[model samples]
Target: MRLEEIVIDNLRKLRRLISVRRMDDAEEAACKIVKYIFEDAPVLGLDLDGTIDEAPEFFRLLSRIWPGRVVIITCRLDEDKARADADKFGVFYDELVTVRKLEDKAEAIEQTGVTVYVDDQDECLMDIPMDVTVLKIRNEGNFTDGKWLYSGRTGKQIC
Candidate 1:
């Protein structure tokens, strides 16, 4: 189902802890997320984790599909960076929010009326409310065409 809004919880996505690849690829891959929330009037909230690649091409893709409409939630409680990043992403938040803990993700998302949230960490995902769409990130191996890896409770995907 197409979510009313898309929420990205991490800037690195998964490349930060998982397999070491070029930063550009991960950023571009993140860009694809914009397609899910294309155009209309719905909003997009990307939870910036204070990473350099917070705004990527995937965001631009969303903007192209949907003009001037997006929201951003920052975990660091850093308003300045969030605003600047919002400008960089081209998907400006109708309003910017900041919090001290990741656990606040669900509460924060709920307040904004978000339906889908994309996050790399399972912990952060758990923190959010269940009503929202939780698009948790998986390692590249999980997305492999042939052999798929199931990341059990330990966060280690067994091939």
Candidate 2:
């Protein structure tokens, strides 16, 4: 059966369980549906400016470790230049999604199927889906509200 057919069937089952107040069953089914929908490989989403370019050395190491799992999501207007910079710094990535606008970041991330998204902007994190883990990489302008899933120092400032 096609993926759409499976999804529709799951939705119908989920609705029936919800209607009967079978909270536990509905939750379990929801989890199973989520697992089946997402791809197996964990994709790491990285911001271009503060996360990657700011610490090229760190990303260089990350690229070595993760290889093709990294996906760069950026709001940079010039995609070619952004890609060129990543290549120059040896920051490996399987995909580069140029967000172009702040509002489009979440949509871009959702489409890419990243498991974890790392960015410096706190507001952008709010737009991303709950299923995707948001890692708030520490920076000069980071939010201290503790809203995101994880916070840590990533990358090194090359001065």
Candidate 3:
């Protein structure tokens, strides 16, 4: 089925659970919906520096929960330092890629076939194809005007 249809069905199920006042079941169903959405993604892309570095624990949890391959795509020059930091932060990833420029991030995502990408930099988030689900990590330092599919911080769905 289409992604939209699947999401709608899941929402309906969640609504039914909530209507019945089964708070626990509703919460479980909500978690399942999120898991299903991420699991359906073939690959998940994450930005290392500002995004993951700002919130290592959150990203670590996400990396562990995601059922698909996680790729850390960053524009940092020092690959060794990035690797060490990732290890120290306990963030899991299938691969770590370093791009020469922030604009190169879009190309990397396309090349890696990332269905969902999370980044704090607007430069990296822009130019990605519409087919990819772009999520913005809430970063007050960086100004991003682009509409995001979800909030990386709270996992809240956005337009």
Best by lDDT: 3
**Candidate 3 structure, TM-score to reference:** 0.64
Residue range 48-140, candidate 1, lDDT tens digits = 552213435565455444433455666766688767876776653466778777678777778987665655445455656656666544445
**If ranked by lDDT, best first, what sequence of candidates would result?**
3, 2, 1
Ranking according to TM-score, highest score first:
3, 2, 1
Across 4-81, the per-residue lDDT of candidate 2 in tens digits comes to 676677778889999999986786556445534654557888888877766778877665455236788889889999
State each candidate's clash count: 1, 0, 0
Candidate with the larger TM-score of 2 and 3: 3
Candidate 2 clash pair list: none
Query: What are the lDDT scores of the predictions, listed in order?
Result: 0.55, 0.74, 0.80
After superposing candidate 2 on the true structure, give the runs of residues whose Cα lies further than 4 Å from its correct spot: 1-39, 143-159
Candidate closest to the true structure, highest TM-score:
3
Residue-level error in angstroms, candidate 1, position 54: 5.8
